[model samples]
Target: MSKMFWLSCCVVLATCFFQMPTISAGSRVHRVRRIVGGAPAQVPPADDPKVYLRFAGKAAQIKGVLDQPHYVFRGIRYGLKPSGKDRFQRPRQYFLEGDIDATLYPPPCLQTIPGDGRVIGSEDCLFLNVFTPDLPDGTEGLPVVIWIHGGGFRYGSASQYGVRNLVGKQLVIVPIQYRLGTLGFLSTGTPELPGNAALWDMALAVQWVRNYIGYFGGNPHRIVVMGQGSGASSALMVALSNIAKGSISAVVAMSGTAISNWAVENAPMITAREIAEYHGCPTTSAMILLKCLQNVNAEIIAEGDTILERTRLTNRGFVTGLNGMLGAAPNAEGRFDGRSLPAAIEQPPMDDMTQGNIPKIPILTGITRDETKRAVESQYQSEIIEKLKGIPNFMDQVLIKNLQNCTHINDAAKNGTKQSGGYFNLLNPLQFRNYLKIARNNFIQGLSKIAEATNDALFNLPAFLTADLWSKKGVESYLYRFDHISQNKNGFGHLFLRGLPIIGNNTAELNDTVSHGDDLAFIFEARNLDGSAMDPPPVLSEEDLKVCDEYTRIIAEFARTGKITIDKKPVEKFSGSNFIQIAKKPKANNNFRFCEMALWAGLADRLKSSTCQFLNALDTTVKSAENLFFDTVAPAQKNIGQGLADTQKAIGNTAQKINPLNLFNRKPATPKTKTN
Candidate 1:
């Protein structure tokens, strides 16, 4: 092992005991002692004492242990407690009084369980963890990476993911915990309170990093904001918000898009009030509702597990809400005070420092092979069917309609069944298959309509359109698709006719498919208590490991430099063959072109076609080829084309009419014509 790796291991092992403060100059001799069953021995002088630094009128201490040659601070507070009246308000600068305990992690924000028995969460949770090799020498500043965790919009925490492995790479890493669900997302629109408090918290954290990371060896100007899921979504918000201009240098958004349907149309005040009423509040005023909610026990708030449960039943499964509404997400109202874009203009906002635009910087965006499969397996078969039982032909009609719209129904079906086995039965297959189809179709339809809408609201049009705009502005953009599948050798035969005779093929298939969050274990390089890599062990073989390593290296490299390519080759043609194939063997030319096109074009179309007046305002811009190209061509077109191609390939020779009940063949029916 290299000196760095050995040093990192020493730091992690010793962290359980003494806290190291600083490292001394020189090559020091060391002795080792064993603690765990067969693990390596601990080096003497486990940790340096905690060090204190004062800034922004607060005194905070940094606690870390020195491994071979590095020090790390686990959890540190960068802001004040945002509880009671402080809830939903912008985070205040954390003021430290005396020697603060910087060794242990702090509690995360309040959140609720989804009735799954897993701990839901809390709102008193604005804390950040920092890891550094060693304090910087004289004038050198270490590059920093700030990671945001993902959990849709309701659940997640930094504590769940550890970064010791990445820290060993020699970069300063900080994982931040922000308020989620009702506490962090609540908005009143009153002069006293604005929505998007969670976003503001992130902004505060960034500001904190800019001001404080230097003490621990981080460069304020070299910070990279990275996240997955909602964390990715929030990172996009920061990347697009005026508040983050000049603060963040680049961003890494995993499986997230910038503009969301939920965020643009829904105002926090409307949803926050609704949630309050659901919780037994009797007022419409946000402040009053918030005040009433403050007295309610955290457990009472957590009990709203019914909301998510019901959402699982609704035709539109898991509606993204303020806490749970379609139109509830962070938008201009919170930051821009509801100002409409320039009149008669067609382009979506692009400047990061202006209005709703976040700072323009290098970005890395990608999604998993079966992004929706986990969500489907988790709720579609059981929860959705139960909810739709009373609706007239809802499953059949909706399923077929959705299938027709899917860009890769057949491929998804084949892959789904291959990965899932018999789990992709006739009844359940339609749910997953149709969902993918309709999502793409709707996105396309929405973009077309937005192009025709009047030039006022262009919210949905901005996501793909912005990507195009950014490319024009000379910003580097890279996109990726993660198609890895986790399956046992015995599981493959069940997905094809060759293995249908198996008694429990369907059940066994579901067992093999790549469900959501399955990739997380690999991405985070998680390990079990026994020190073995987590279940669904790293998919790549040695050859593939080189690729995986390269992919990771590129990600880190991009974080350091604003480019995704190391050579002069166009990013579009630079396939990620160096990374291990998450499912199949790594191939040199397998780019995510079609998928990218579909997403960009479909999203633009969704924005155009939506009945939302705000989106309708962007019609003029969508009409012009230049505008459309600027908005959709680069990002969504490639993905869309790839998705369509994949879908066609999956359907194979099946000429069966699109039937929602048929799993692989279905599409959304046009709104029924009414007889005169």
Candidate 2:
């Protein structure tokens, strides 16, 4: 080694250097006495492997393990840490230096586990993990697939996903982390605290990829920005963003559309105030409150971020309420509003539904068949049906009100199904009365009724509308409805509310099955943080695995080429029913597509044409296209000022004592849905 290397090693290995007191930085160094019988001093194995790449006139040496056919780099910094002074602010592009020892994955962004408000993860967490077949070089590159994980915008991490399968030799996979919950999306519509920081963070990541991906064996020009669920929404938003214009070549949005009513927040300022004061940061001034939040610990911030959903108010004993029901998520930064603060707008609006700012790109979007089954709490099934029968004022408060709440994240179909107090509407020849009657009777009957309605209103309608919008514009768009119901022990298509699979008999009942996020198993090999596969590893039946293989083939192909297909046929047969129905092997129902189209979209023709004709008479006056609910579901307070004031009052007027410990640390009831 050179004299400079000796000096640097001496400084880094300070304790070892101290033993040799005579050693000098610029002098010839002599070895200290070694152990008895030592033939020669053996150098320690390099702590980690290193691979270097130069991009944008800068160089980085990444150290990742040999993950077989792929070179895997974990916890690669995609942007500067959005922590301390930068908390809640738009993400700043992370500058680079030195050997990027990206061997171990970084901690997840700070977020509370759902059900209980216990926090996990760190704030200094803006990293992307890359899995590539080719190492960083300056020659030709492979097509890139950048992944964004989904978690209702409140919580999720890059580490939660497995990218090995996605990073086939033909594709380079990069999964990135953005700020989540209060840390990421908190905003007051002020320039200092504009919302949609996560979106901006995603935009920043896209910029990073465009500038540096080529060095990592990824073609910067052939980047496919893909996201699932909230990530899907974010991906769409990124594509629509002014900053990311000409950055992304294509998109894959699974189970989400930015146009859906639940996608964007109308009142993040109200949520911010509630969060700040509830977490003990009492200040009317937005700047002071923000400063207080910056000083707060990430754990407290996580608890505070989730407090809104947990804290319930007695709204006349029917159902408890919170000031803000919607979790801390992406909100309008007032970029388009002419009168709003101009500085709050970080980037000009690009993918807005109403603004018609959608990007011109090849898009693939799809949804699971029973999305609302996940949206509706499984435990509430009995109570839902019970409340619909013979109970006074039950129809309004418990049923319709809860249905309204579901509209925020689910569907507004409850508005059509649920009946008001007066019997007059029932007596009259109302066009929608039969539809309402069928819905109410179904609600009275069992789970499937409300479940189906909510599914259509929330997941299906939004997905269909997104595809329709692109199709109407003559843009290349592929649509799919994932109907594969897994009956195996670890049903590939069925997971409980906590995301653990519903095994054995639970998987057998494929009636109202195939919950949300279940398709993930097909895309990746699920593994734990310790770099080992999960204990009781999530397995697919041979049947389900076959389906997984097919979907995987199609998705991987889509990532490779721009086209989406299964076998040799196009994924969607829009000429007939417009969507490809992906069920298990031996698709039994021939008219399943036409029948489902009628039920979910309320298509009169499909309803009339299919075997289920009794439901055809029920009217659907409001078109799914017309009922875009994302920006529409504001709860009373129209003005931001009023909402904030009311939110403050709600925070101040607390009758019950809050034991943050009891509320936060109390172990949740059995895991119902996936945690991430």
* Candidate 2 local Cα displacement, residue 26, angstroms: 53
Using lDDT as the measure, the top candidate is: 2
Q: How far is 500's C-alpha from truth in model 2 (Å)?
A: 12
What are the TM-scores, per candidate, against the unseen true structure?
Answer: 0.62, 0.72
Note the clash tally of each candidate.
90, 12
Candidate 2 lDDT over 233-282, as tens digits, reads: 88887776676889898888887777544466655666676676666664
Tens-digit lDDT string for candidate 1 (1-676): 7999999998898995576433344322222333867767655466754656787676766566664445656557767777767766677877555766666555655554333434444455677877777675544466789988765455556665645555655578888988766666655544434567778888888988998888887789999998865577678777666666788898876655554332332334545544565666645344556676666655455444336334422423321111122323454452334444211111122223222233458776655544433333333335333323322223223323333322222222333321101111122222222222223223333222222120111111223233443444456766555555544322221121110111112333454344334445434544321123445543434543444454565666677777654343434422221121233333333423322232223333323333323423234433332111112222333565454333333322123232222321223223222211
Stretches > 4 Å off in candidate 1 = 1-44, 57-60, 66-70, 113-122, 189-192, 262-270, 305-315, 318-328, 334-358, 382-469, 487-515, 527-548, 566-676
lDDT of 2 at 423: 11
